[model samples]
Target: MPDIISIGEILIDFVSMESGVTLAQSPGFLKAAGGAPANVAVAVSKLGVKSGFIGTAGNDPFGRFLKDTLNSYGVDTCHMDLTDEARTTLAFVSLTADGDRDFVFYRHPGADMMLRKEKISEDYIKSAHIFHFGSISLIDEPARTATLYAIDIAKKHGLIISYDPNLRLNLWPDEETARKTILSTLNLPDILKVSEVELEFLTGIRDIDSGLKALKDKTSASLILVTRGIEGVDYVYRGERGHVETFKDVKAIDATGAGDAFVAGVLYGIHERINEFKDGHMTSKALQDILRIANACGTITVTKKGAIPALPTIDEVKRFLSERLER
Candidate 1:
């Protein structure tokens, strides 16, 4: 049985080959399996945890590609659903000169959004130590019902719930809808991870301390991780606050799945100490260790290209950290 089960979209990202070009103006593109929850599943698997992905993908080449890619990374896709009603979602990513990205999606009710509540497996949900998800699945029907239903099952089984509201405004009807939907689920996850931009958007606070406080006010999460890109991560656990500085030597070639990689690191850290969780003794020190590795994971990811391909294995992360510390 897998230790972590991630439920959400699993799609392919077509990255523009040229830098500083719009999707329409790009000469060529590269394909990679992406989606925040799926990325985290692979990252956790690579770090030596048994991980599974639960979602729907189109019964097409792109969908097959995603399933194969997840398997290659040691992620179990046994609980996944393949549908012919909709094509697999595709996002065209345009890379900016500063390594940021813009996305143009081609998902007119993509297969991922078609996941029904009936398709989610109760046995599979009960088997995992943690249930991880993102807000993308909550934007539409059927999938939204499925997501909430899974969370309920996970809660019933006492699995640690993890959530990352990897917000993409283009997928929602409006900012208000996005805000309302995402904010409503704040207190649902035992572990919550959000980027700096998401924090400001959700809480209307740009300052780091204020933003964290705002989120804490909204959720009773055991851990709230705030990713700060190059500056590193800010975390709050059991009323203790800490920050971890990111690796400075790594140059970001692309910023696609960096946050997802960080999420994996955090989950892996927690998985390593599942016994502590069972005992209800998740200390601040344990959380800081998790964030430190998570920062390293994000640092390694952006230094490469693509999302899934950019993710580092456990040995790679350890070696990178060792080399950086000795420098």
Candidate 2:
């Protein structure tokens, strides 16, 4: 049985090396395997966990490349669906002077968004300890309903549900629809991971405290992880007070996939029974250990490039932690 099952989009990212350039305008572009759920699967696999990914991709070369990449990373691709009707989703990412990213999507209801309810295997959902999903699958048709259906089955089977609203604005037709739909699914998740900007945009609350409260009140999720780039992470449980921890500084080459790497670390810690978050209480020591490991994973990912390719192994993470401790 797989330790974790991630269900969502699987696609290719065409990233520009230069600023103010689109895929067409850039002098050079790099093709990399991407998509949030795929990244999470790679992250989990890199940490020595049995992880599986379930999503649809075209029968095209890009889709084949993605599947091959996932298998090479040790992620089980048995559940991946391939169809010839639609092409693979493509993301064109442009970097700013300060390393911030802007995305342009080339999607006309791609294969990932065409996932059908019949394609979701019962054995796949029941065989996993955790079921993770993202917002992209909620943007479109049969896939929207299919994703929710899978979540319901996973919850009924007593699997822990994890959500990451890795929001992409360009994909959604309107902000209100995206906001409403993504907010509605919050209650179904046991753990929700959101970036600072995502929290603000989701709740319309500028203050972190207020935003956190608003999300908790709305979703009733006992565990909430809020990631702040460079400043590390802050987490909140039912009775425990939230706290922020800073991480050691490193020369970050690319910020892609850092959050997914952190999520994988937390999941690995939970799976190994290292630091489990209780129903109503979480100890500070436990939280600190979780953050430390997560920070190490995130830091290691930034030192590399790409999303799935950047995920660090368990030994790499330990080595990073050891070096940082010595410093």
lDDT of each: 0.90, 0.84
Q: Candidate 1 has which clashing residue pairs, if any?
A: none
Clashes of each: 0, 0
Q: Where in model 2 is the C-alpha error above 4 Å?
A: 19-25, 278-282
What's the C-alpha lDDT at position 209 in model 2? Answer: 81
If scored against the real structure, what TM-score would every candidate get? 0.97, 0.95
lDDT of 2 by residue, 178-290 (tens): 89988889899888899999999899997878888887887857778888888777777764656656565776666778888988887777666523553434567776687
- Candidate 2 clash pair list: none
Q: In lDDT terms, how accurate is model 1?
A: 0.90
lDDT of 1 by residue, 1-327 (tens): 899999999999999888888888999999999998899999999888999999999999989989999999889999888899899999989999867899998888899999999998889899999999999999998899999999999999999999999999999999999999999998799889999999999999999999999899998687888988888889888677888888877667889999999999988998899888657687777777777888888888888779999998999989987887797
Candidate 2 whole-model C-alpha lDDT, 0 to 1:
0.84
Lowest-lDDT window of 10 residues in candidate 1?
277-286
